[model samples]
Target: MEQNDHLGQARDVTEFPFGADFQSILSLIGDGVVSTDHTGRIILFNRAAEDIFGYTSDEVLGGSIDALVPTRFHDRHREDVDRFCSSNAPLRRFMGEGREVLGRRKNGEELSIEATLSRQMIGGQHIVTVVIRDVSARKTAERHRQLVASEVAHRLRNTMTVVNSIVTLSARRAASVIEFKEAVLGRFEAISRTNDALVSGSSTDVSFRLLLESELAPYRDDDSKITLTGPDIALDGQGAVALALVLHELATNAAKYGALSTSAGRLNVDWKVPVDAPPLLDVTWQERNGPLVAPPTRRGFGSELIARSLGVHGGTAISSYAASGVGCSIRLPLTGAPPLPQ
Candidate 1:
């Protein structure tokens, strides 16, 4: 067994023998602990080092440290090691300094790592020890967090744009300040309900059924008066918010003058998206058992908002006040719907 001493000289180290007990203690450590002499030849490769780099202690003994580092970093690594050995700095860090720490594996793959280096005199010889930790999982988690944050920011910006459009158009159509305030507040409430549904879901956006149910939740009771029937359909950020406002207006109209206004009244909301290159949402808002209906003498701002809320690219809305009931059939080009699950 080799010995080390206070003077750091091989011959003088007889006072401190390197034994199996010392090696076993190092092997128990979680981080890879690698030690090298003045020549950068690895003298001790602990079990954790073998697990990290896929190299056995016998295979890496007396080997240069470069074998464990990426090719691009070999030169800098050697230079830094030389500096550390010559300087009085007791310890050094070589990861997370606006630079990545990489380690090469026996299979030629490079892995992310963090390491701390320290130098000491043992029996008159310079010895360098490094404590290395694998950081790949941490790096992956950080990237995922960044992606989620960016997605949330993007959705918030789109929501603000939708709100701005609603306020601007409502203000232009209002005859009085009170009308403008009520219109804007109602639309904002719809958006708030939609966002609440989104918070309950695991994804960044909510499903179409969830958004619809949220808008009509106030009236739903043991009667199952408010029902949603459609395939599970995911809506993108903007689509969810826009559709929520439209549904809220429909429910408001129903509660005030349509089926929801009477105990015996019934409302049926059914939607379908036919298979096409770009699918279209066919939504039917039918009211039954309500007061005799007649076409409105003048179109209201609420009706106008429902037509304009979905945007102007391609959409159709037709409302009829029949003798039996009041209803609307809307065909909207569904854009930004999520892909079907695998």
Candidate 2:
């Protein structure tokens, strides 16, 4: 009798501490924790499990764990429980173990959940413990990040379109060895600037007034030769780059053979965005008081650059050789700027 009494005391001491440890560990978990018997009946539901599934522990303790599973999974879940009970196979019980599943809330709203399940023997019976966490917010954030990355990539491609045009046209216009070298060098420099801007992941749209001033800076030595007037508007990276190259090519030509070739010439640039046109931006470049004006007998680099830039957006340009001066009018559809690197 004494030996049996001592053995009983030892068992009680071991079991009591073990139960306390198990409860302590379960209480610390943030996710829902549930234990089911070999017959798939719930035996334990932690406080977090009650909060997560919107069921009181008393209501779930003697019920089937299937109450938390979606109706669509009921049949397969029974098969799985049977297999697990028979084989006592080790089931994964961590974040990456189970296929993504939906858990139904008490309010009938469905939530995306990740589950980890494990099996153990308790009181001579096999039981399954499941830990579940809601992953909806994490999934949402991942999708949002992917969408932003895709948009940025699309914008960068659009910006490249303008860069490609500038390089092609500028290289084609080089007649003299020196002229060709300068054009190639200028194209490279422009591409470098574009790459620098893209690295920041900023939206590619830039203030139009700022772009114009920056592009026209090369001609600032004779600041009196050029005049600019316009309200500040933003252009997408592609539009800004295209317009900048067009202006650069025009300025280069004028300095070599057009208005800027002589002291008596001046260039005027102006823009207007009318509300009736919604998003359309209208701009004009006018050359005045230059030497005798005449259209090039053959289409040159300046002509090609302007035509291609406008052509991409179904735009139109009219170059006129009036008695007073040469005037070029370009009309482009002002669609919201294409995605491109800032």
- Best by lDDT, which number? 1
TM-score of every model versus the real structure? 0.70, 0.64
User: In candidate 2, which residue ranges exceed 4 Å CA deviation?
Assistant: 1-24, 27-90, 93-115, 120-173, 221-227, 258-266, 289-292, 337-342
TM-score attained by model 1:
0.70
lDDT of 1 by residue, 200-268 (tens): 777766777777777777777645565566676777666777688788878888888888887777888
lDDT of each: 0.78, 0.70
Residue-pair clashes per candidate: 8, 2
Clashing pairs in 2: 155-339, 155-340
lDDT (Cα, tens digit) per residue for candidate 2, span 1-342: 764464344334324546878777877889888877676767677778777878887676656767887888888888876766675555654533446677877776677878877887555667687888878788778888897788669766876776666666666677777887788677556545544444453554666666566666766667688898877766665665566666666666767767777788888989877668756678887888888877678987768777887677666677887756777776666667532234
